[model samples]
Structures are given as structure tokens and as C-alpha cells.
Target: MTTETMQADDYFYEFFDAVSNSTDISYVQKGDVLLCEKTEVNQFGARVLPTFYCINFILSLIGNGLVLCIIYKYEKLSTVTNIFLLNLVISDLLFAFSLPFWAVYHHSEWIFGSALCKLVGSLYSIGFNSSVLFLTLMTFDRYLAVVHAITATRSRKTMYAFASSAVIWFISILASVKDMVLFDVQPGNQSMMLCEMTGYHHNIMKKWQLIGHYQQFLLFFTVPLAMVLYCYIRISIRIMSTRMREKCRAVKLIFIIVLIFCVCWTPYNVVILLQAIEMSNGDQKQCSDTLDYALYMSRNFAYLYCCISPVFYTFLGKKFQTHFLKLLAKRIPCLNITIVTPTQSSKTTSFRTPNTVTEH
Candidate 1:
């Protein structure tokens, strides 16, 4: 083995941290080969990542599942915006499905076999890419629905939404094919067999890796983020000018979702982009402990988007909150709550004697 090999593993994990092989085994560079010196695991990562994954797994699964149920239960919830949100939930679920494997891997090593490795890696990429795409699309959808209502009303349809979702999912899955093909199970620091990228010819592996990093940064981060900001800016300006109370509320909700998305993902993308560029120098230079720790933390924040999104949806959408309460009331007979739907001139929604009405 060589330092180059270790560097390759680090880069792979930088982009997709949860199940990527850990750099536990320490080594030193010799004249031409690298000799394994000791098995020094990252204690911080070992302690932090598993717990983070477990919590995210529980919250995302429950929250996203409830979101799906609410959407399915109410016809009013299936608008163009909510349709995009539905797919967003589905993508987040895809991300969550991979977390248990990641949780286990963080506590120990990659106990899963080669096929599972490729499957999990591909799923992670698919989920992440599709989720961003959906969010970006949601921003555009909101911009049109708010800014150009007439045109948007004519074009937004259930069939069209499903068609767009299919295209995004197709592209996302296609982007993940490289991960499925390149990653394989290999011997790790100890007796551990780890799953990581291998089999690239030396002449082109560097170029290939660089290209992959650039693709991820562009497709997953830069382009979508830029579009989101631009759309939301225009949306904010348009909504501010309008005196519609509902639109004002909608603006607040959109702001929360977009802000959370950026806060969660931006740092992780930046760190990965910097790391990819630095590693491309082929010097086998290791990153500082500070940068390494930051990467670990940033990746966790990025994963938290899955859990955080449903929380925002629940809190922001009055209809969603009402349905959620009704659903909750069903299980707990003592919570006989009543919900009143909003009327055009109703200034405020009110609950009846046997029920409670909640406003957003």
C-alpha cells in the first residue's frame, strides 16, 4: 500500500462520510511504499457520528413518515409546491434508509459486504442529489406560483409534477452510477474489510477523482444553491410588495426552508470542495486536525437536513399542523381536539366547543 491509497480513501469519505471507510490505521511513507504503523482511530468521530446518525435516523424516519401520511390524507395538501415537498420527503427517506448502516459502521468498521457498500453509497448520492434538486425546483415552483400566478396556475398540474420528479430522480440515479461501479470492499487498517473506491488505473484515477469532486460540487451544491438564492430573493421582493396576508405567511415559510437548507449544507460543500482541490495536488499532504474535525461536524449538519425539513413543514403549514393534530388525536382518545379551516375574511381561525383551532 501507499500514502496515495490512504489519500484516496480520505477523499471518498470527505464527500460521503457516513459509510465511507474510516482512516483509523496510521501509516508512514517509506521510499516508495507506505508501512502501516499503528491503528489509531479518531475518537471524536467514533463518539460523535454514531450518536448523530442514530438520532437523525429516528427523527427523519418518524417525521418523514408522518409527512407522507398527512399529504396522503388531505387532498388540499397535493398542490404543486406540496408535490415537490412530497418527493423531497421521499428523497430524505432514501437518505435516512442508509443511516443505520452508517451508524453501525461508525461504531465499528464496514461489516457490510461489497454489494451493500455500492448500494449504500449509491443510495446516499441519489438521495442527496435528488433532495437538492427537489428543493431547487420547489424554489422555482414557489417563485412562479407567487410572482407569476396566472402562468403558474396554467402550467402546474399533478401529472406535470410527477413527470418532473421522475426526470430529477433519473438524473440523480444516473449520477450515482459511478459510485456503484467504483466502490468495492478492500482490506482496512486492522483485520477489517472496508468498502471504498478502487480499481482505477493510476494514470487516470487522479483525473477521475477530480472530475467527480467537481461534478458533485457543481451539480449538488453551487448550481442549485445559486438558483435557490436567486429565486427566493425575487420571491421575497414580490411577496413584500403584495398586501396579501397568506402570501406574507408563505414568504416566512419559504424563508425558513431556504435558510435551513443553506445553513445545513453550505459548510459541508465548501469543506469538501476545498479538501478535494488540496488533495488533487498529489502530494499526499494530510489535512490539519482542525479541518478534519470541521469536516466531521459539517457532514453531520448536512445529514440533519433530513430531520429538520419535516419539522419546518409541520410548523410552517397550518394545514399540515391541523392534520397532524387530528392524526395525533386519533391515537390518544383524551385529546379530543377540533380544527377549523380558514375562511377568506376570517381574520383568525377559531376552534369550536369540542375542538381546538390552531393558526400558523
Candidate 2:
């Protein structure tokens, strides 16, 4: 209450603020007075990441849209595997819808506001979760069709596929709700509004981020990966014993599918897991700077999966390629396209047959 006491308190506060601002590490202040101190951001991301996202967005949109059109235009391509591929396409396309926003976020600030941030972030999560789940489901469907061909044929229904898709979407949306709740627009050190998680406190933010990274590792990377590996391994073993002449190509496609998924996502997941461990274990200062660099590069590569899935679809499905070319011919009028209705032999017993197409 005295004038000298008030002056001393003011001086102490100013000195503390000066020390906090002059320090290298981020500081946590008790009061709401925000300090804008210069901290290093991953400059490589700003320089290179936007281009990757932009290319992913364009290619995924076109490729997925083309697949959807082909599926709708042709009635013979609605097998359970194709249906799952449809879901995968939809998931990737929806996720691709968020890439433009993310490209902007990486290149500059998050000017899209909190609600849009939540929407876009949530969509990204849903897309990724659903994409993984769909791939898992597709592998299982193949397993059932190959190993338990009679049961799969007798029990298959369009309604069953639709119901399963509904459940997948429900689970994916539930997973993404946390992202919507956690993400918001917050001020960064450089006076930029960033759309990211900023907890009510620094400790809470770190805890939540670590939890998120682990959650992604388990759900997206580990569990589905295990399922895919199991199903594909069994499918490979079973196909080897069968009399199908296309066994080599089938096995090759299976390997490519699993390989692409793992190669694109595993490194990114590992980087995040290492970052999470470093944060939780209190080795932030000792962590390698290359971790930050790897995070940027791996993430860009992982995001490419959205565009890459459609490439797999186009390459592996001869019928799909035919339909896709036909669709293109219809649109462009100058290209000559021949239509081929693929006939499957009875021995083809896999879910990829004329019967499977007809049933759907």
C-alpha cells in the first residue's frame, strides 16, 4: 500500500519479465500476460510441406472422384472388396478436403478460425482412422473370400457391407471428436495464430500431446497393422495351396498394398513416438535435431497415402482400370475407349468374381 512498496513490486515484476523473455526455453507465466519470445520453428516445413500437401489434395480429389464415378456408372464393380475400396476412397477424399487448409497452416498462419480448424482437424483424423480400418477390413474380406469361399459367398449382402461401413464411420468420428475438442486457434511466439492443441496449462498440453501420439501409434499403426499382416499372411498361405492361376499376381498385389501402407506411415509414427517419449521422459534438450527434420519429411510422405491409395486401386483392378478409362473417354470424347466385361472362371472363387459383382 505504500508508494515505495508499490515501486519495488513493479521493479521486481519487470525484472522477472526481462529474464523470462531473455531465456531460450519456453516459459510458463502465472498471470495471463503473454510473452512473445522468439523460438525456433521447423523452418523446413514452411519451405517444403505446403507443396506436398497441395499435390496430395489435387491428386486424391481427382483420383477418388474418378473411382467413385466409375463405380456408380458400372453395375458390375460392386463386390465387397470394391465397396470397401469405395469407403477407402471416400475417406481419403474427405481427408484430402482438409489438405488445402493444412497447406495454408504450414505455409503461414491458421486464419480459418477455431470452428473451421476443428472441422478440418477432425476430418483429417476421421480420414486417417477410417482409411486404416477400411484397409484392415478389405484384407479380412479377402481372407474370408479366399479361405472360406463358400460361407463368404452364401452370407454376403450389400446391406452387410453398408452396415459395416456405418460402424466404421461412427468409430472414426468418435476418435476425431477429441481432436475437435483439443484443437483451437492459439498465438505462437511469432505473433501467428496457430491451430493446434494448447491446454489450459503447459503440463496439461504436454500430457495430452503424448497421449495423442501414443493413441495414434496403437490404434492407427500397431493394431490395424497387426490385423493387416495377419490377414494377408494367412491369405498368402491359403492362396499358395489353391489352384488359382493368378496366385502370383494376387500375392504381389497383397504385398504391395501392405508394403505401401507400412512404408508411408511407419516412419512418421516412429518419429512421433520418439518425440512423445522425449517429451514424457524429460530429454527435450538432448533429443536430436534431426527428429524435427524427420517429423516434417515423414509426415509429408504419410500424407501422400491419400493420393497413393487411388493409384493402387487403378493398378490392381483391371476392371477398375477399364471402367476408369471408359469414364475418361466419356468425359473427353476424343479418346477411343473399348469396353471389356471381364468374365471370371468358377475357380476364381475369390470375392473378386462375376458372382460377387452380380450379388451386389
Candidate 3:
């Protein structure tokens, strides 16, 4: 109650609007204690609770599920690069699976039991942290592949990547277990009770909550972001300077991944961080209409990024598209496939396709 964060029952209309049109300036007001109680929802906003959760659930299921299916179906796609993808899809699915429960908690009263309330909320946090960690790692992997060719090719490097993923998942689970067990539903709040640090064991709960936030920042926000930025800078420089034809595919893949990272996550964290700072001071400051609007806007756009991640593979990752197009051509019997052999006069080859391929 005293910490910085929007209460569980915060409204949606302003939330969406604020996030969509966010400002670079911090929303934190000095001398604010976060002790706001929920009031009646007097028929405002377009019932964003259900809409937000439903859209996120459906998108994550379809898109992340497809990514999983693609990797599992094709043996060749199980490379070092795609292993990171598999982690990403799995993280998205973990987050998405809990959306329906949240939607129910929002649309209908929290009819799903207390056990589910804690479980869903905890998993959501875990998935979010894992997603950030994996995306950052994936960027680093790409950066290494492009910048340090021999190291990337070594067997030990691949082993180390897998080892790192295992550690990330292990820590993510441990971080999540506390929420799953310790979250106490507020008295008489129906389904509105989400994960919170109860004052019952104030000292312990506060420590855990701060630890969780710090861990999330370390793995997800701060360190990973710095790594990603550095990697992208190095990668951009390498791509611009080098004339290596073979490296083009890898460069494009990394570029799209980096772009998605910036677009999806930057807004949500900014809101939370600023909110936290404001709450640390002792005033229960009401979120300005502008701040509320930006926070919600970021929430919607953030999930869209998660859902559209699989599509990035189709458009930007060259290897995925090649196999996918071939498969699509096979599925549509009416479509003709054209094959041309190399004319080895020079070091170049040419091929003609019968139709334009659409990237998913």
C-alpha cells in the first residue's frame, strides 16, 4: 500500500491512453505515499480489462505456439540462434497462459480461486523477467556471432549459451515462488487482489519485493539493456564496414530482434520505475491523467510486441523464411516452383521464383 505502483483495481481507459502517449519526463511526484483505495467504476472506459487480457492471451497462444511448432517441426532450426527463440516463445507462452485468469479477475469478479490468483500473477512476473533476460541474451548471441566469428563457431560457446539459459530459468522459478505462495487477498476485494507485499510480515515482504524488483532490473532491464545497446552498436558498425555476403542474414536477424526489444518493453518499465520512486517519498499522490494515460498505452503496445515476435522471424530472419516459403509452395499444389542451376562463369548465381513470397 505504501510502495509505488498502481493498485490492482486501477481503471483501463486512462491507463491505455497514458501509455500510448508517454513523455520522457518522469511521472514521479516528490513526497508521495502510495495509499490509494479503489472506488466504484461508474461505467467509464470500454471495459478494457477483458479486452486487454483476451487479446494478449489469444495472440500469445497463436504466435508463440506457432514459433514452438516451427522449431520443433524442423530439425535444422534447432541451432544456437533458434535456441534463444525457443526460450523466448516459451517465456511468452508462460506469460500468456495466465491472461485468461486475469481477464476473468477483471471482467467477472475473481471467480477463479485464490490459488489461481497468486499463481497467475506470479507466473506473469516470471515470464516477463524471463522474456527480458532471453531477449537481451539473444542480442548478445547475435553480437558475438557477428563480432567474434571463431568464438561463436566453437562448441564450447554453444554449450555456454545453453548453460546460461538453464540458470536463467532456474532463477526465474525461484523468484516466482514467493508470489505464488505469499500473496494474500485483501479482505472483501473479490477478484481484485493481485500480487502485493502484505504488511502482516512487513519486514520480510518488503525485503522480498525489493529483491524481486532489483533482480528483475538486473536481469531484465539494466544490465541486459546495456548489453543489448552495446551489441547493436558493435553489430551496426560491423555490418556497415564489412562486405561479407554470408553475414548479411545474421545481421538482419539481429537488427529486427533489437528493434522489437526497444519497442515492446521500454515504456512499461519507465512507468513502473517512476511510480516506484514517487511512492518512496511519503505522499499518496494521485497519478496525473497524463501519467495514467501513458502507462496504459505502454501496456497494450507491450503485449503486441510479444505477440508479433514470431512474425519477425518470417520477415527478417532469412533462414526461417526460406524453409517456410518452400513449405507453403508445397502446401499450395497450384503454385509452381522454379529451380535454376548455377552458371559457374563467375562467383555469382541466379534463381527465378514464379511468384512474390509474402512474409508473415
- Candidate 1, which segments miss by more than 4 Å at Cα? 1-31, 34-41, 76-78, 246-254, 344-360
Query: What lDDT tens digits, residue by residue, belong to model 2 across residues 322-348?
Result: 666777788888777777655665324
Give the TM-score ranking, best first: 2, 1, 3
Task: Record all residue pairs in model 1 with backbone atoms less than 3 Å apart, i.e. clashing.
Answer: 338-355, 338-356
lDDT of 3 at 43: 15
Per-residue alpha-carbon lDDT of candidate 3 for residues 247-332, written as tens digits (9 for 90 to 100): 46545655666677777777876775665455455334654444455666676777666665655543454344454556566778
Winner on lDDT between 1 and 3 is 1
Clashes of 1: 2
Q: In model 3, which regions exceed 4 Å deviation? A: 1-46, 76-78, 155-158, 189-218, 245-259, 286-292, 313-315, 334-360
By lDDT, the best candidate is 2
Q: Each model's RMSD to truth, in Å?
A: 8.3, 8.1, 11.0
**Worst lDDT window (10 residues) for model 2?**
1-10
Model 3 TM-score, 2 decimals: 0.73
- Stretches of candidate 2 off by over 4 Å are 1-41, 76-79, 286-288, 332-334, 337-340, 344-360
The local distance difference test score of each candidate is 0.70, 0.71, 0.59
* Candidates 1 and 2, the one with greater lDDT: 2
